[model samples]
Target: MKDMSENERVARAMMATGRYFTATELREQLGLTVEKAAATLGAIRRCKRYITQVIGSPRHYKVKVLKVLPSPTWHCGEVAPPELTDRQRQQIHYLSSVVFKPSRGIA
Candidate 1:
């Protein structure tokens, strides 16, 4: 598995709790620098899938987890390219015949 960045770690921790937090609270709880805590919280809040901005002064944010399922048409089996249409097949046939035909004029 890939290693998580500090930002990702902080976001995941916040998401796990699913609670509202402010930048100062993050700094105090995580022992981060004032700027780092504010930056991390700002970055996390921008990711709509993971966090949401709550209505208030001083900017409170809450983490949210969204469930996503694989598309119904998606499959893990072998994949094949789509077959050529009749018009495409005809074009290929014409081009092939033109290229491979005996060069009577040159000969």
Candidate 2:
């Protein structure tokens, strides 16, 4: 039997639950603080390929098992970047319009 790491254990627990969970629920279940839960969840998501973000909310995620065969040449499909929202576009435009002037003291 192999021992699982903390994050792996968390992922397994979530999988066992067979549903998506919010950070607060995970925190309560794992006896962790909000910040710790969020940080731990974030790290787990980054390290575990099977763990995927839920489409509706940033705080939610789901674990999906994908079986991929090993091959000499295997390439995953590329995903296009999400389109910028109106608020994001306005922020970008505003920032782009601003010009930074070097101070006299700065070399």
Candidate 3:
């Protein structure tokens, strides 16, 4: 795997296309320990031009910057849910956390 510096990783992560990313997923992709990944994300949020949206009351592990505009919703296909049941939302949220992550961080 190609090694990356913290700054480079943070830059790439900031530019990544996604809704959000968990520190664990970032750690895995960037080859960094969890602690280091978390620290890098934190630093980026603190020092860079980024915006965050809370999926819940302050969703963790996300520092959203440059709003990634979502595709326009169309009635041309099946809709998943208008209002997800609690259990379904939980499942969706969990899977989402895993699928989205940073491209760089440490080690």
Candidate 4:
């Protein structure tokens, strides 16, 4: 089997976990520069089968990978989101709410 590309590895990791991630986070996690992170995200977007929409401001985005069953064989390639379960959908709704909650503090 051929070795996984850097983007593929990052994509797999993100897909395994069902949580949103920003470009900055991706840069930090992948040790990439700002430009590289942006490029990488574009690459991921092209390959993602599900969870294609990236919602957020220009600088920040909420991204997640739908849990998918692994192929029968050891197949490591581009990343794609899976069909979301009802529970998963509920979780995303809740998390998105919390993530977008404004902080209440002294101005």
Q: RMSD per prediction, one decimal?
A: 9.5, 11.2, 21.6, 18.1
Query: lDDT of all predictions, in order shown?
Result: 0.64, 0.60, 0.59, 0.66
Please give the distance, in angstroms, between residue 49's alpha carbon in candidate 4 and its true position after superposition: 5.3
lDDT of 4: 0.66
Worst 10 residues of 2 by lDDT: 65-74
Model 1 lDDT, residue 77, Cα:
33
What's the C-alpha lDDT at position 87 in model 1?
100
The digit string of per-residue lDDT tens for model 4 on 1-107 reads: 65756666777778766566677888777688978877777776656433445678765676665543333334454345579999999999887788766668868
Tell me the number of clashing residue pairs for each predicted model: 0, 0, 1, 0
Q: What's the distance in Å from true for residue 75, model 2?
A: 28
Off by over 4 Å in 4: 48-53, 57-60, 67-107
Residues 1-107, candidate 2: write the lDDT tens digits.
33555666677677666666667778888888988877766775666344454534555653332321222222442345579999999888777676543355945
Q: Candidate 4's error at 35, in angstroms?
A: 1.3
Candidate 3 vs candidate 4: the lDDT winner is 4
What digit string (tens of lDDT, one per residue) describes model 3 on residues 1-107? 33554645564565675646666766777787889888776665555334444242344746554542332334554445487799998888887786665446776
RMSD value for candidate 2: 11.2
Highest lDDT among the candidates is held by which one? Answer: 4
Better candidate by TM-score, 2 or 3: 2
For model 1, how does the per-residue alpha-carbon lDDT over 1-107 read when each residue is reduced to its tens digit?
34555877787666666666777878887899989988977776665435354545555553332322222232543345579999999888888788676676964
